[model samples]
Target: MSNPLFKKINIFLKVNEQTIDSYFNANDPAPIYKRQLSQEFEEYIMNYAPSIKRYSTVTYKLNCVNESDKEYLDPLVHAIRRHFSLKKSIREAEFKKFKKRNWVLLTFSLIVVMFFQGVMPLIFNVEHRIHSAFSNALDVFSWVILWKPIEKLIFYWNPFLKEISIFDKLINAPIIIVGEKKEVAPMEQEYAA
Candidate 1:
């Protein structure tokens, strides 16, 4: 029977054994076994050039081939299986990391919101005095503006809170712009050249 690897190479499958080896050595040694399997498959493809027929999705079979080649192809088949398994593990780990980061950010943003909500009434009464509908509205607006900096500070200090909601971001925009303005000092009359 022909080696499947050899046929894959002929069709430009683009599997780099050396690169695979390097990656396996540097991070994960498991794929090395699969790389060896791939090489063996390539050898079989070169020798027999087996007539391959796709049986199903991700499954293939050799037609009109000798049974003798099966012994040599076993390792190659095992290697392919191992490679896929390792690839799946890597992907799962990455997804978990992404989820962890997202969760942390979300928790932090919620905490900031809670903190703001708790302090709002006290701070508003102190700053504005005599709470009324207008004062309450103004205080809420001021709190919205300050939320960004407060959220950022909390994130920086805690490192655990990172998730910020769209509402929180929108509330911060106007305040951020307002915060950027510098007070104009009393100007002495100076003629521009």
Candidate 2:
């Protein structure tokens, strides 16, 4: 038996002038490190998204046919890191907003429920027939009003955190460049976590 944490997951990228353009938006005039990744390239990367695990040793392996092609390595890696880092930041903001919204909703619902149960009783005497009916109705209404936010708070948050985690992993994953003569370029200092 082997520890799953030791498993290696490699995402391979062929780096060169011709293929580099295909990785980014063709219409974008920005430099490679600033350009948005193309839809096809994003989709290709996402195909491996589900396989990533918290302890998985994920890496990006860049293969360059010529030594000249290796010049593009730093820019390409920077682009990838920038893309996923932005995604993680956006997801974190969204998660924060989600938590705040749900908390507000739950608080509002509790206040409304309390008013219905507390103040409404004073309007109708306890012995009145309509009192019981209104009380039961208020209980049902409170449950209905609170259901959505409670459900969201309990069950819906895992996906947001999951996406953020995935983006973080992608942003920090090690990148290795392999050249034609089987030479391994030392990891650039800027790319190191």
Candidate 3:
């Protein structure tokens, strides 16, 4: 029986002279470590993407039939790291942009609300019946104007942070190489790009 607390999610890849190229985009002229992953390969990995959670662990299980095939392991791991590292960086940038945009919108909405609540009141004498009616309308309008930005600030950021966390885990996940006859090679440490 396996320990329930130590859950592992394995993404299996067959590493060899023939299949290695299939993992990457053939059109990319860059080196192996910098090349973009193929769409099919990415889809294969994304099948396990949603299963990653706060307590779950991800591992790349590479199957190498020949001794020479083991040489491709480092480059493959490096490419995976680089790809997800780039993804994480891009997500961080988008998250920053999201925060900045929402703050700006909230600030602008507050300014508008202030103008309606403060400046508009002086335009009409407070004792007049029209002034009392307009005051109530403006109060409701202020809340309506401020609703979207406040809602976005409160709720919309969770998904971005969650995706960034997933990418971070993928970038630093461990790698395990397995050979024929059920023999396991030594695990490699995190590959930093």
Candidate 4:
């Protein structure tokens, strides 16, 4: 079913072609492609929310209301607000936790890198031990050791930022608080008596 109220709204974003294609291909870009891909879902909501309220007894209105000026009537609106608030909290928490985890991994990788850079020369004759197995291993290991830092630096933060942004939009979105109207039935003569 289609909702006409939001038919003209355009929330679609322009991004890389590969990113656009990935969304349709059922590819799992997850954290990496989150920011661009999430726009589609947001667009979907922009179109659907009006229809949802139009059909249900629940309705929503957008306006500036001070804390003291508001009246609460519907439980459904409260539930919806609570759900989005919880989502916002989870998004914030995930961002903090993921950033901390990335920092920890980066620090460990830095230690491994520093051991090779500063201490290795003093403790082991790396240049003189050329062609030895341990020397070769060190040569290979140094490059391999950089992977975590590279990954954490380049790709790790995208998911948290994108997800948090999505949650923020959702939590702040104005929504229907309650019933659209109350129908009053006319009294019959017998009932009027």
The top-ranked prediction according to TM-score is: 3
Off by over 4 Å in 4: 1-73, 126-136, 176-193
Assess each prediction's global lDDT (C-alpha) against the native: 0.40, 0.88, 0.87, 0.50
Residue-level lDDT tens digits of model 2 in 1-193: 6567446778899999889999999899997789988889989887878887666767899999998898889888888889889889999999999999999999999999999988998999999999999989999999998999999999999999888888987898899887666544567544654
Question: Any idea how many clashes model 4 has?
Answer: 2
For residues 124-150, what per-residue lDDT tens digits would candidate 1 score against the true structure? 665454556645665576567556655
Which candidate comes out best when scored by lDDT? 2
Candidate 3 collision pairs: none
Candidate 3 wrong stretches, greater than 4 Å: 1-6, 182-193
Each model's backbone clash number = 13, 0, 0, 2
- List candidate 1 segments past 4 Å from native: 1-57, 62-64, 126-193
**Per-prediction TM-score, please?**
0.39, 0.87, 0.88, 0.50
lDDT of 2 at 51: 80
| Model 4: worst 10 consecutive residues (lDDT sum) | 67-76
Per residue, candidate 3 scores C-alpha lDDT tens digits across 84-167 of 888889999999999999999999999999988999999999889999899999989998989998999999999998888888
Error of 2 at 168 (Å): 0.4
lDDT score, residue 5, model 1? 49
